[model samples]
Target: MEYRKLTESEIVELQNQGCVASNWDSISVHRQFNTAYIRHVNFSGDIKLGIYEKEFTLPGGIKKHSGIKNVTLHNCEIGNNTFISDVNNYIANYKIGDNVFIHNLELMYVDHESSFGNGIEVTVLNETGGREVIIHDKLSASFAYIMSFYRHRPALIHKMQEIVKLYTQQNTSNIGTVGNNVKIINTGTIKNVRIRDYATIESTCHLENGTINSNEYDPVHIGYNVMAKDFIISSGSHVEDGTMLTRCFIGQACQLGHTYSASDSLFFSNCQGENGEACAIFAGPYTVTHHKSTLLISGMYSFMNAGSGSNQSNHMYKLGPIHQGVMERGGKTASDSYILWPAKIGAFSLVMGRHYRNSDTSKMPFSYLIEHDDETVLVPGVNLRSVGTIRDAQKFPKRDKRKDPHKMDQINFNLLSPYTVQKMFQGIEVLNELLSTCGEASVHYTYRGCRIKGSSLRSGLKYYDIAITKFLGNSIISRLSNCPCTSDEEIREYLKPDSSAGLDKWRDLAGLLAPSTEIDKLIEDIESGRLTCIEDINAVFEKLHKDYYSLEWTWAWDKIQEYFNLSPDTITAKDIITIVEKWKEAVVKLDWMIYEDARKEFSLPTHTSFGMDGNKKDQKIDFEQVRGIFEKNAFVEAVLEHIKVKSKLGEDTIERLSKCL
Candidate 1:
């Protein structure tokens, strides 16, 4: 990319083409620069022009040579084969890369030294100022989670902030980069933004101070009427359709469109948000909200689906929208559902209707929070049998759209992991305490600002037992799958914990689910100044995520001894067979419940409103045509298949155990 002096003939040819410059001596051109086609272009300050010899094909099959027309460049370097034309204002203080296209843009400029959205503190979660995460190009959801929420560890927070500041300083430049093969067509204003290779930014309104982390493999798109400021949109993401964002970090393959307005939020991979307003929220992987009336504010969420008209109140009359809530992974809200802030809903739980009570159900995962006559009723562990829960778990891995090999976020998409299983273990103790304190015959028990009925308590205990057995059995079976033996010594060795770390509490730090001990180690490293780089922090999360299964087995081994009352050292084949049978029963019973729930969709009551113009028989016929019979439903059929597969798997494992015995 060496530049040579412009020839006298070339200068004369440029003068003939109406191209003017402040100082002709200060401008340099490529060796093969052709000034014949340049027209009405004004160049100022230091400028370098490359040869425009490449031809481009328009959408309508018209071929045109790459050349500038009716544009103004201010202290810019134009690369070879790049076309810059019809800029209404001026392209100032920028380095346009090779083969880049900038057409019909109102203004594109870099004003002084800029980080291009890096090191901009995003006031997430609390939204006041204590939890300000400095947004960087490599800032994943997990890292942001720690930086925003783990403020109690001030040293770790300071270290993380310093690391981000170092990254920002390293990335600071006066001249912004428009990477090779980029297209900025029909855009309005792009100020201090770094456009990456293969990015298609068409019809964008205004993009200021952001880094579009696009590459050739997975090109990012910022489409019509999109206004983003102080943002870092990662690769494979699409922020289009009039979406407005400020101080946000949008992760890989995420979609934010249809007039979605988000501020001070972190949306991670595969999240689809539309027609909603999100403020100071942490939206993790697969957290989706598609309704305009849905307002998710001052909350932490992951693998969640906010239903239509779902709203959460962050402020009581005393506080000024300062309080926040956490809906753990796989949680869902029914339409028009509401929750007061400072509440914590459990993982895989469902919230229905409006409740003013601030409930904490974090210890009771897979539960339901239903509002009955203005009272919040908790039905614990009922969602373990839900078809939707299983479907959501199965679909997440299949829906991953990130094609980049270097995935920044290490997402563990397991539905039942050490995280939830630990909660279940705690839930069993809590339930037993409740039953002990308030006798078994008590009609209802009150705990954590929610009422649990007698029937619900009994059912919850049963559901938790089934889930715990299933998890422990699944872990043990997986461990012994490849190493089958008849001896109790071999079984004990196989069931022994791989690592002592997983025995402690587990946490879902956004997308990275790991034992709290591992998180503590990361914090300790940061505090000791051993982990300073963002890459180093991300590497730790990746390591923990990769070793999830091994850690999970460790946790399961401890639970098997505690809950099943069987010492691993002397456990026989009969015990393994019994566990496998329990697992099979839990698996099939849950699937059958889901199957029966699916049948409710095609019941007579469901057909009452259908075929309103005809009789009840016509209603049934109409329902059959439109909704189809429940037996023929796709999800129902899948549920049946799941039941059969799990049942056969359990029988096969038990049969193998019987042979060993």
Candidate 2:
């Protein structure tokens, strides 16, 4: 594209068409520029324009030529076939892309050199500044996970920071970009922001120092009075309806709307926020808050849901909002629930009522933390039988909205992986120690700022045993599902783990669950100058995710040997058969427990409100119409079917092993 001054006849044609310029020599155009398309435009200071020969169709089917009209541009290069109209202030220092439509915007410019939103230090998790994550355009949830939690490994942190700093330096620029096929309509001041291809901005109030990493495959939408500063919104996300954010990072496929206000926070893939407020929090994958009164402050959460009016206190009046808390994945809070800071809640646990005491229940997964008469009561292993927990596990994978091939977060949606099972094992040991020391006749036992009743403690032990049995059995069965083994030696060979990488402690890094030992090895490589880039770190995470099941068997094999007190060298066909029998019993028994739990919803007491104005027969009819009979319920039928399928699977495996004897 070449630009040149207009001829004498072309200058008269431009003057007749209401085009004015400070100096005609300063205003240049394409060699084939059409004078017919130039109308009602004011240009100043080194402006260059591309040839526009096409027409743009408006949303309501009105068509207009693709040219600059009713606009004033300064120090800009307009692309071919772009339409810019009604810019009240001006668009300066911008390189507008081809096929773009910019209309009714107040001002769009770049003030000086900027990195968009990269390298902005967001003080997350701990507001006082011990945990600060520098956000970048390519910042994945797993990368941020290691930076925020791996504070003990200072070398690893410094290495990651250096890699990110290199990325920021490469992206620093003077002129902003509005990529091809972008639409900006009814927008207000956009300053030092970088817009990517195929992104849509409609009715936005203001955006400053941000990067919208949108593309044709996964376009981002910013709409309707939304205001953001120093933020990075990733692909396939929607931030709309008066939502205000400052110093935040919104990851892929996320949704934030309904005037939700957040500051110094990081929200990862598939998270949702509406009508709530967040400050200095790390919201990992699938975190959702839908109510206006919910305030999540200074906490780490993943696979979490906050009910209406759910709140947390991060300051104790002595410290200046320095207190922090951790709620492990799959945690939920009831309406109006509150938790004081410095508390650690376990995975898949539910919190109900207000708990002022700083309780730590990380060793007791699948439990309930309830408030009874101003005291925090812990009921361990109750959520294992909850229908809601099962539903959550089933729906998480289905709700994933990321359509891009390169997903930002590697989420693991397993309900009974080694991450939670390890906690359950510790919980069983703790409960047994309490029962032995306090005597079985004691009414209540206290541990870690909460009280557990004798009956509840006994039941918790039973639940933990059932879950552990199910997990180990699932692992072994899956490993040998299609093995061609007819002898005891062949069966033992099939049970041998493929690798030893997962034989130790495991961790859930936001959503990607893997062995902690492997993560440490990767960190060591980084500090040793072996793995030096962000891509290298993410590739290691991808590899760990790819080999999850192979590694899972190694850990499960070791646990099986320890739990049953039998080694592979001496174990026979009879021992394998016995484990299969135990597994069948555990699976069927747990399914029966869940079935009975669901039946409580249809109990006789639950029909009290349904029969307020009816006789006995009418009451039965009304209840059947609304709630339906428990035997015919969908969830009940699924539970019964699951029991049958699992029982048959276990029995068939045992029968096959009998031949080896």
Off by over 4 Å in 1: none
Question: lDDT per residue, candidate 1, 150-219, as tens digits?
Answer: 8888888888888899999999999999899898999999999998988999999999999999998889
Candidate 2 regions exceeding 4 Å error are 1-12, 22-32, 45-48, 53-55, 604-623, 626-629
- What CA RMSD would candidate 1 show? 1.6
Q: Model 1 clash pairs? A: none
lDDT of 2 at 510: 91
lDDT of 2 by residue, 1-661 (tens): 7788778888888888898888888877789987877788888877878888888888899998888888888788888898889999988888888989888999999898999999999999888898899999888888999999899989989998998988988888888999988999999999999999989999999999999999888999999999999999999999999999999999999999999999999999999999999999999999999999999999999999999999999989996899999999999999999999989999999999999899999999999999998999999999999988888998999999987778888889999998999999999999999999999999999989888999999999999999999999898778778876588788888988887889788999999999989998998998898998888789999899889999889999999998888898877778888888899999999898899989898888888877668798888889999999899999899999999999999988888888888
Q: Score residue 579 of candidate 2 by CA lDDT.
A: 84
Q: How accurate is candidate 2 locally (lDDT)?
A: 0.91
What do the candidate models score in CA lDDT, each in turn? 0.89, 0.91
